[model samples]
Target: MTSHRYAQWLRDSAFGSLPHPAISIAVTLGYLAALYPGTLPRDTTITAVLTTVFSALGACTGRVLARRSRGRPEEQARRIVFGSCLVILGSAVGMAVWWQNLIRSAVDVAPAGVGWCAAATLPAAVVVVAIVAVPRTAAVVAAGALALTAGLLAPADAGADEQRLPVSSSAQHDPGTLLRGELRVGEFDAAAADLARSWTASGGLSARAVVVAVPTGSGWVDSAAVDGFGSRFAGDVRVLTLPYDQVPSWQAFVSDRSGSAESAIAVVSAVATVLDSVPEHERPRVILYGQSLGAVGADAARVWLENEHPSLLDETVLVAPPAGTVALLSRTPRTVLANSSDPVVRWSFAELWRPHGATGDTHVRGPRVPDAPWLPVISFVQTSVDLLGALDGAAGVGHRYGPEQAGPPHPLRN
Candidate 1:
């Protein structure tokens, strides 16, 4: 009786325990659908069904692994296989949610409010608990989760924000001579000034042009743009990066987004302050960049990029700017880079409100490779591993943007 009770206890805890796993469920399905971006139906009904089935399977697999993990090698093998599936499915769900939200709504993608951040990270936690019966698999899941957590924080970068730069030093800075400098006041203002000074110091800014970059959800400043654009961009252009104090919650994310938007506006304002001190010929031109939630903040500041000043913010370059980004004023030279494979850039359905956008000389939609002929089986297998590519911070043609195998020439500069 005692042995039977112990077995039952193990079975109960392991099985049927993902009662509130919607967050995990969404992420898992989305990642899978992304494998064959063009091949998949991309319908919410399909995703809803997949999420339900995946959740049920997760519950079933967790239980079976828990019950049979202590059995013979064959049973342990089954546990390993099941445990592996759980982690893969969780990522697939994430991909689906990401795709759908990109096509759906930019501002409130993934229901940004209340307990959203916990929902974002909980699936991995759930996986850890479910696979505990298999020590080896458990370790793999835990390690993967830990690595993801690290990438999900401030990405490896070097730049100055308000926390590092101050207003007093603003007068002393020169755009042509600075390398890595400091910050103060609103994060965007301090960083923008730093870039302005760097450009002046380099004495290489082309037409005084610059690319103002906005960080992602984790406040990761994009080094890709800075490295890719190079000096002709500013003679010595400054990739003026804006900082949003990220606190790891939807409210905080949203709050930071609003602040980042306001800060983006303020950055423009700060650049204006510094530029006013210099001659019109010496002032640097400005452009923009953002991704995921960063796109939300950067895009929200689109108005400043438009009217009120002819020379300021000559153009706008938005990467995966999200659903419902307002179309730029007809005259604004803007470029929007999007990927059909990234739900973070293009998921939409009837229940979801996908905002309309502009079609212009600068719009590009792709994943480097043309979508393969629709094959559900192949797509699923492809995206399963592709998500790992996303976790590593980037990819050539999928969700996260990396090297463009082939794309337009000089988008921001043009």
Candidate 2:
């Protein structure tokens, strides 16, 4: 009798219906705790990881039973119900993370609870939609759309409030009109042409010098710098900055950088090719300048600059170059105005990639410049208060090299 009872317990435990609900409930609870954060830790990394693993497990279990689903309605229904609960819980957690971040940014206070269930019915609604939705194709597309939306809506860097500006009319040096976001190459040319014509009318070509400036992430042109160049150099110093290939975000900065660099080469080359056709005396000395991602664009333009027009760009001014800048074109004699405490520019130095080393060091693109006795021409400036500044704002506060930091005669003004 005892042996038979132990055998029965083993069979029940191995093929038990109990495991399904037990795993589901534990996963659901973890997700709930992560998503709700009512009085829990604001840091959601651990819970987010837990919910992700459980959701994946639930999905795998459902898929394993999919082949036999038609034969057993009851079993199929159980798996379906379990998977549905995991997804439902996941949506709740995603929203909670978003909400908690938002409120924290707004009030600058610690949230008391795990997170506010501002919309308590959100999870139920998501589950209902998921159940009724047909064709897994739609779900895949929806998931992609959700990710894109989240990336696009990410918060701007600090001081964004003061930095946000539409590309508009200039005060002193006419930096072409304000650019709209995500422009095609042709559209950019058209805008540049319009601005060039205006610049010519304002005695631009007559001054025999031009400066093309790139704005920050939020499309802010350094009016002060442009204005300063116009006043200090006694030249028209025309400035033309551009918008992004798409909505700006830190995550997609590399793609944005690649696009901006390609565009810069094309637009600047076209403009320069035309200007170079003029008599050497009549041709304006073309200069390049960019801040943040635009600074990145400046660095990337080096590949083409060296390949196509080695001496076309006479000078360059890059302020607060972000991480991943490997500007190898020392031929342009560029000046990097960095805030010593700014992690943005500092990260660029730490971003070492040699021809032989760790996996991250495997950059097969042309020559490795960082180790090449590289004269970065960096002018690092900082103040006492800059120690606490983040990568984005340190340059402005510590180094005082912001858009408004213009007005002084820039080193390239010579």
Candidate 3:
């Protein structure tokens, strides 16, 4: 009698856990379905409403089965069988709708492949349901163990290829001249490194040039930027790493306030002070470079320089300027390099700017390629990996921006 009672208890426990596993599976499917971008070709609203309804039904069925099993044994058994069927059917319907719609829409192409691959484990799903319905704790444990083993053995590469590349020694170069004035406080070092690399990669055009690297992200840190690219400039490249920390955060300053413009004004004042201190022949040509969030900083600098210190800036390069910044720096001849696969730039252009009315040339898109010769304006496209790698301080040849492959015999007509 005790053995029979133990067996009954085990069965009850398994029945209770069934709904949880089912709900988990359904939730996973729903998440995967939502990852598909773009509008649904069919009535998305109806499809979405139905998907939610089926998910709720599956959850409710599981709960009813778990509760009914604890009250009347006969009723519990009936509900268990019926509830399992409903849960399975509901999940199937949801999956079928999602799968069918995915096949019909181009946006769903990637997700469809993923979903079909996930659905290949239908046998495992059945085993999960069985384990949940079983009352014996030992049997439930065995089933779980089996499920885990099957999942582990599924065919897939578990590791990624790890490789290393030679590090660039360009991060040790020094600034030939120091612009004497109040430094724009911020992470100037990071921006300086990128500018230095660009200057060096351009065969030393940055030599002896006053490279003004505006700080748009954080406190100015000139060590990284200066050390990275300073050694490659042909002449002494004077780095004026702006310190923009007088404000709270760099992001807040760019988004909420006009601190960047104010910072640019301060930088302009410092540049004038430096130019005045140096002999007429010793003054370097000013080249401005900024990236990512710093692109906004570069924009503010361009506006300030063109409007206030026009004589100081020789050329400006704005790499991946934030949306709406194009107009800010439109009057200044600028080169905007964007990552072809960068979601930030793509979304910003497609959703943000296009919806509103903003007109600015997108120099490059698709993949990160070598820099093209567009006279005073040069645009370089970088791969996502290359861009992220460079940003993360990874030393690699892939991170280097070189000359373009093919283009017109000459640069774009001025």
- In order of appearance, the predictions have TM-scores of 0.49, 0.46, 0.44
Q: What is the C-alpha RMSD of each candidate to the true structure, in Å?
A: 12.9, 13.3, 13.2
Alpha-carbon local distance difference test for all models: 0.47, 0.48, 0.43
Q: What TM-score number comes out for model 2? A: 0.46
Candidate topping TM-score: 1
Q: What would the per-residue lDDT of candidate 1 be over residues 1-414, giving only the tens digit for each residue?
A: 698897887657644233223323343344344333432223343333333334434544544544554533354554555566578865644564554445334212233232332343454345434544354576566577558756764332212111232334432332342233233435556665665565455553444465556655434544455555554443345556545554331333434456657656765665566566667766666666666556666666666756556566566666765444435443666666765554334322211332323345335554333344434353434443333323222343445464331123465443
Worst 10 residues of 1 by lDDT: 156-165
Model 3 agreement with the true structure over 331-399: per-residue lDDT tens digits: 656666554323334223233223322235445532332221221100111111122223221121221
lDDT of 2 by residue, 332-377 (tens): 5666665433435444333333211112211122111112121222
Model 3 ranges off by over 4 Å: 1-29, 32-34, 37-207, 220-233, 246-257, 273-283, 326-329, 346-359, 365-414
TM-score of model 3 relative to the true fold?
A: 0.44
In terms of lDDT, the poorest run of 10 residues in model 3 is 376-385
Q: What is the lDDT of residue 213 in candidate 3?
A: 62
Q: Rank the candidates by lDDT, best first.
A: 2, 1, 3
